[model samples]
Target: MPRRVFVHIGAPKTGSTYVQNVLFDNAERLEKAGILIPATFAAHDQAMTDLREVPWRDPEAYWTWDLLAEKAAAFRGDVILTSEGFGAASAEQAKRAVESLQPAEVHVVVAARDLWRTFPSMWQQSIRARGTWRFEDFLAAVEKGEFEGFWEHYTANRMFLRWGDLVPPAQRHLVTVPPPGVSHDLLWQRFAGVFGIPDGLCEMTEPTANPSLGAPEIELLRRVNAALGDRYPHRMPYQRVVQQHLVKAVLQKRANNVRFGVGLDRADWVMALAEEQINQLRAYDCHIVGDLDELRPAVMTDSHSPGELADRQLLDAAVETIVGMIGHADELRQMIPPGHSGVLARVRRGIRRRLG
Candidate 1:
């Protein structure tokens, strides 16, 4: 039976991808040390989706948590399962998660970020997930209970409310994301500590970071999303077409000087939320890997917001993005295999076959 389990429930954009990448990069080394990180657990993270009972494109997501728990029950070593999805698991979902990982000592780790920082990234993330809300409106909605589900991910207090009963105070960990411009190595070190990974076991080497958009680019995409509502209604097509193709190929290549931020007026509220979270978490006395003050957002003094973008700037960016998409189409017209079943197409076919 597994002796230990560490579940890294992420509040997104806190360098979770980089952590997962490092795990895969040194899987063998980690396994030899009596720590088992299954490739499925690290790469797909479908288990969280299963636990939360959320909809996703993966056919295998339905039973992924049970499958991993089964694997964990059979293993003799410690296991680490990570997913940002778990950060938003409801109380019932969290109970189910605890029950499934039976007999093993389960620990919860939430690498949470400041709302000021995480909210913007999450707005862009919502757009990437085919949401059509403007940044301002998204902020307003999330501030209220209207989109509390999204808000729950970044709030450790709410997360703890759901999962705190499942584990002892010592087993619950709050790994605060270091402030902007701090070395990510520090973040990795914190994660390694919570995972019981020893320092210098593997060459930290270079890091893999997911490319993210600036405020203007994200605003442009938001406008584009509103204009093209429901054309790619499902997750996979929207992901392949907008998220993968247009955003990665076109927008990410452009030089974006605008930074996303909360206004100076809003900074006080952001800090208050941080204070509330820190106070709530302190009562739990959870093992903290980094300073809780780091969760207090540093208000930007010279931010260039998406709303401040000029009409000409947006027009030029849109034109350039269209040109890039055209070039990608040309490349596909030249290079794609005749019977190429793209991933979404294959999934659609599979779903139809299942229905048939």
Candidate 2:
């Protein structure tokens, strides 16, 4: 049989990072078991230049789709294209993605979570991307249908149709995140089943999840985004610092155990909306793994709101976050090799010679 392909088109924050972590951690073993993670998730971004409707100065991007295809085609076994972003592609873009990986039976796997729970996390993600919207405003944007990406990602009813538009219902699989308190690794097991991987196969790579921020921690980051407005016009520098360093290295460490969730007022609407979405998900003819009812989130009460937090809460978070940045900066500087320090290298050398 031709190589089979399993693509985890994400509705992000639904264990996408964990899934990729497991697959990548056990890449060699998975490959030996006749499965190929064709490329890193970021590498696939190059393959979507056309789908993004963006211009590419890098010639390599022009052929990245083909190159991804070539890697898949050369592999003798199944291929896995894992990216949460893939879950956001429009129907036409998804069709293009499907076409590029032709001559193989391509299956799509979507991991979905409770809609009400996803929003706060999604807002945290937006803040990481330099959004200055307060928590309440973010929710307003979603309800008003103003937040395009949020609508596309959080609505399983909409994304399923778009991603499964061309693929058959049977091959379009849904993995519902089991509600809290169940086996944590159950999500991976559900995913492994859909991807045709044996459970506990190849030592079953360590379970991992992305770092998350508490409400106050995320609020602090949102304010920081507002303060840094227009400073780094380029995406890379900001992404390198705020996203890669500040968020990951600093803010994430400042998280209090206090979980963030929708307020009672927002919960009323979000729960209602999640119910509507769940009903719509029932309408899809796709195969379902795990309980679909798990998508219905209970109204959350014990939660912190970014807008409603006390000044003290935010001040405490900010102070620690600042300290974390300093410590992290020092830690990073320690990791740098001595000779790699440019002109500082000459200064240190002269000091050492005088001491000698």
Candidate 3:
């Protein structure tokens, strides 16, 4: 049986992807040191999706949770399972997970960042996930408890409280993301510490960052999603074509000089709430790896509202979108196998392009 199980429950926008990439990159080295990161994170992702009862494209998600737990319980060395979806786990789901991985000393690690910083990134991510809400409207929904995902996954205090109920305080860990403008290497160091990974063992050579959009870029995406409406209602198609190809592989590579931020005037209540939450977390019995103050959001001197994007900014964003879509389309064209399937696929794409 595994001696220890480290669960990295992600509070998103907190450098989770970077950490996962490092782990995936160094899987062989970590395995040689008696630590096993499963060959695939797909099972873990499906498991979380099933646990949350969220709508996804995978039918196999319903049972992957149990399968992954079984794999972890049966392993002989230390194991690390990571997924941001675990942050949304209910008390019941947490309990079920704990019971399934019996005999292994389970520890939960929650990676977090300032709510102010995370909120904008979270809203932007939602847009990528096919959400059609404007930035201001998204903030309103968050304030009204309409966005339970924000509270459940992004709030540090709430996450520790829920997971603490399943595991002892000694087994609960917190890793605060370093302040912006600092090296991201520091964040990776703190995360690796939770698994007893020695320094210099994991090298970060790949550019695996999932970059966020500037105000104008996200604003344009919101408008596009609103226009598309139910035309592309399915998640898988939208994820592959829009989110991965257009957003990740194309749009993020564009040179945009604008930054997105929250105004102090609009963030007064949020700041107060964050301070109060951090105070409570300090009192809670858990292991903290980085400075707690880092969790306090830095106030912005100027905030850019997506509603006020300049005409030039809008034109640049539009032109970039067109260029990115054309590039992504060609890239996809090259991916199809050269045969009957390729010919039919090209014909369908040609008809769509001509019709548009």
Candidate 4:
């Protein structure tokens, strides 16, 4: 039988970090189980960096696919490659991706969630990626679907759709990650199944939390961006240091009171949109594994006391900022080429040191 090749192209905000960490950590074990997660260098971190730097433009843009084929060709075990950013590929990119990987029985696994939850998480992700837009304004754009341009560029959903347009429906698998009620293990099991991993070969041992922004926290972020917009574009590394490290860290430390609740009106709008999306997806005969109803929004309830909500919100934001910093640490570290001038190295080192 031909070796199977699985591509877990993430539609982000779906516990992708945790999944990537697991695969990276257990590469040997999976290889023993006839599964291969390829890395050009012995360093696991290098694989991630390569994925990040893979070009998506021009004649040489199919380099990632070439890299994939080269990696897969060398591995005897089933091959698996993953990157959430792959979900944002343009149509031309998608076509090239498919053509480059031809002859491999490519199975694309996309983890999806209800838009109601995904929307807010995506907004937080945008903020982390240096996006400067108010939650209300973002929602307004989403409602108008004027966001199709931005969505086409940044969202995994659009990429998934485009990929589906290029590939046979049976070749794609849509894994719906149920909301908080379901066991996280169960969700992982479904994912593993799609990748053809045998039962018990993988275990969920990591407690990676990719928390989303509560309404109050998002509102605070909006205000911070608005206040700092002229002084610092959100994308600037300096602003990232201040906002994510200093400001967010202080707030996260004092979880006294910072609760956020969506008003009934917004909740309703979110639910309606989610339902519409779910209906549309069903038309594609996509393989949905969980209950779509789990996506329904609930009335806002305060988990923390009113007195504590403010502090807690600040604390959450701070933690989120710290997490963001950690996520970027490796990339920053690799950017400094070895044997550079001492002064240049010092400057790079100082910037990286500040990240912690």
For TM-score, the strongest prediction is 3
Positional deviation of residue 315's Cα in model 3 after best superposition, in angstroms: 4.1
Indicate the residue-level lDDT of 19 in model 2: 76
What TM-score do all the candidates reach, one by one? 0.88, 0.87, 0.89, 0.71
**Residue range with the least summed lDDT across 10 consecutive positions in model 3:** 55-64
Model 1 lDDT per residue over 310-346, tens place: 8987888788889989998887767867766486588
- For lDDT, candidate 2 versus 3, the one ahead is 3
Clashes of 3: 0
**Which predicted model would earn the best lDDT?**
3
Q: Tens digit of lDDT per residue, candidate 3, span 191-220?
A: 988889989898875546566787778888
lDDT score for residue 289 of model 3:
95
How would you encode candidate 2's per-residue C-alpha lDDT over 216-273 as one tens digit per residue?
8878878888898688544456676778788877776554576777767766787787
lDDT of each: 0.78, 0.76, 0.80, 0.61
**Per-residue lDDT for 1-356 in model 4, tens only?**
22667777677777767767767777788889888887632232333334444432222223345665677777766888787766666667666666655576766777776665566677766765556676656777877877885566443356567776666778778777766666677777777877777887775566564344454555555556556665654234534575556445443333324443333556667677667756666667555556556545433332321123466755666576556556556656677678664767688799999996
Q: What would the C-alpha RMSD of candidate 3 be, to one decimal place?
A: 3.4
How many angstroms is residue 246 displaced in model 3 relative to the true structure, after the best TM-score fit? Answer: 2.3
Q: What is the lDDT of candidate 4?
A: 0.61
Alpha-carbon RMSD, each predicted model: 4.0, 4.9, 3.4, 7.5
Give candidate 3 misplaced runs (Cα > 4 Å).
60-63, 144-146, 310-312, 331-342, 345-356
- Which of candidates 2 and 4 is the stronger one according to lDDT? 2
Q: What is the Å distance of residue 108 in model 4 from its true position?
A: 1.4
